[model samples]
Target: MSRPTFKRILLKLSGEVLMGQGQYGIDPETCDRVASEVKAIVDSGVELCMVVGGGNIFRGLAGAAQGFDRASADYMGMLATVMNALAMQNALEKAGVDTRVQSAIPMASVCEPYIRRRAQRHMEKGRVVLFAAGTGLPFFTTDTTAALRAAEMGCDALFKGTSVDGVYDADPKKVPTARRYDELSYDRVLADNLKVMDASAVALCRDSDIPIVVFSIRDEGNLAAVVGGEGTATIVRKPQA
Candidate 1:
């Protein structure tokens, strides 16, 4: 079958991808490398935006489990995503790509507040928009934020860039026999707890009918390849009739 096409896409990046072989924190070299990849896509005429996770800096659920108040912890987690978003914006701008950072939590000094129409205008003018702070609410993962933003922006697809190239039946890093999926039904991902994304995120995407393409961002140039429909990745959406 011919690969699916996309005019606009939302790229969801895990905070861990910024670590660049380190135990923690953002790596400048890594950020620049990822920016280069993004620049390639934008230069190809694909409208792109991003939602970045904060596990590399801090995770709200983990913080809450470690004695912090759940709400406060989640807010802190949201702040971490803002940091990642800013870092990405810096890198992308350095790569000669116009970029904007929108935060759900509304830190006007640092970035613009999340305004859907404003963001849409940014993309329409050929700028990359980065959505930060998951849904502006506690307890929602950035995965869900990605889905929400993708739907709001009318994205053609959602690209999830992680360490693994695709979704697997098991943890491929741990399970030698784990099988990677080329495509999967949303129901199967949720019913079987496949973890391609959080349940709410997967359901939102399914509801919005946006295909989630899971690919490895750690592999340099893989983002462009995946966006071009020539890379190895897994696509999750409703099962065909």
Candidate 2:
């Protein structure tokens, strides 16, 4: 595959990645490592923004499954994302990277509200923006938020950092012989339910013509390598004839 040169990118990280080896919550060491990877990309002059899921702290659907009010649960989940964003902001700042936290839900006291122009300005000033609160609405995953923000920010690509290195035909952890795709069409992924991301997120990226790069965040330094198109990852975009 040819290497892609991207000037700006949005990184979507699962909240579980912040858990490190633990069962729940943010792990300081993991945050620091992730922050360091981010710093490398920034040093390379790639404008970056991030959207983090709240699965490790709270999951709206999981809460609903446990009998909590759906909307209320989703709101709580959004708040969890804010917490994760704050943790990431702290780590990034400690790494000597300028960072800002923007929440869709508008907690003025904790962070700035989601403002596209302001975020763009922050990036122009070389500050990473962490978008939290998952679109500030129920029934939408942080994946969708990433796609939306990536398009709005006019990013070159959306980098999805996951536990797995790339999208596979089957669960790689369970299916020893599962095939990992070097590249895939967004339609194929959605049609086959490949699970590269939520359906909405996939559709949004497809519509916007934004390539989604799926790579493992657990491997230290992988983030920088993948962004540089020198590491293992699956690129999901429109398939050529």
Candidate 3:
């Protein structure tokens, strides 16, 4: 058996992943499946942190476009993330994994609020901490939050689990022939305008010198594979000398 490549990881999940068969709601099946995968990973001795997107339930920017206040809309998006985080927390605990939901926005009535020192303690105690609310501010996507958390947590890798398995030269959905990159330079990802993540998020990871592992989480066990350095991902890091 091969050794796991990381001691710790920060997983960024899209809110749409929780929707399952529903158009805009939490799907118990999807949550349970994800929880199962996470439990499997935890059993392998990896510390984990998570950041979930709120696009499935709501996107503040979408509301802003509909003539609503942009900041208010973003706050709403943040709240949606809290809901997803709580749902995920429930699933993980049911799977027998210790999990914590730390919200950027204070909601003491439910989960704990984001506190750097306390979050570190949670990880050291072998609990998976989920970060929600997008930096607790407007105009920043959860991608940046993932990148920021990975750097702060000093994780070995930042895994962006998306619908696609890897970053493509073009949108594979639109261009079937779009070329995929097994390895990519941080500079190139930004210059080409690849949809892997937002410029701010990619830039943060780049500056922090953390590699972003892009992979598909739909298939069971892929997360474990990527974390184990099985080479089933697009690894984005600094260019070689």
Using lDDT as the measure, what is the rank order of every candidate, best first?
2, 1, 3
Candidate 2 lowest-lDDT run of ten: 1-10
lDDT of 1 at 153: 100
Which runs of model 1 end up more than 4 angstroms from their true locations?
none
Q: Please list all clashing residue pairs in model 2, or write none if there are none.
A: none
Clashes by residue pair, model 1: none
Candidate 3, residues 1-241: lDDT per residue as tens digits? 2223878899999999899768998998899999999988889889999999998888988999999899999999999999999999999999999988999999899989899889999999999999999899898989989999898898888999888889988888999999888888899999888878889999999999888889888877898788888846798888766
Tell me the spans in candidate 3 whose CA falls farther than 4 Å from its real position. Answer: 1-4
- Full-model lDDT for every candidate: 0.94, 0.95, 0.89
Per-residue lDDT of candidate 1, residues 121-199 (tens digit) = 9999999999999889998899999999999999999999999999999999999999999989999999999999999
Cα deviation at 232, candidate 2, in Å, is 0.4
Tens digits of per-residue lDDT for model 2, 178-202: 9999999999999999999999999
The lDDT, on a scale of 0 to 1, for candidate 2 is 0.95
Per-model TM-score on C-alpha atoms: 0.98, 0.98, 0.96
Cα error of candidate 2 at position 109, Å: 0.9
Cα TM-score of candidate 2: 0.98
- Those runs of model 2 whose alpha carbons end farther than 4 Å from true positions after fitting are none
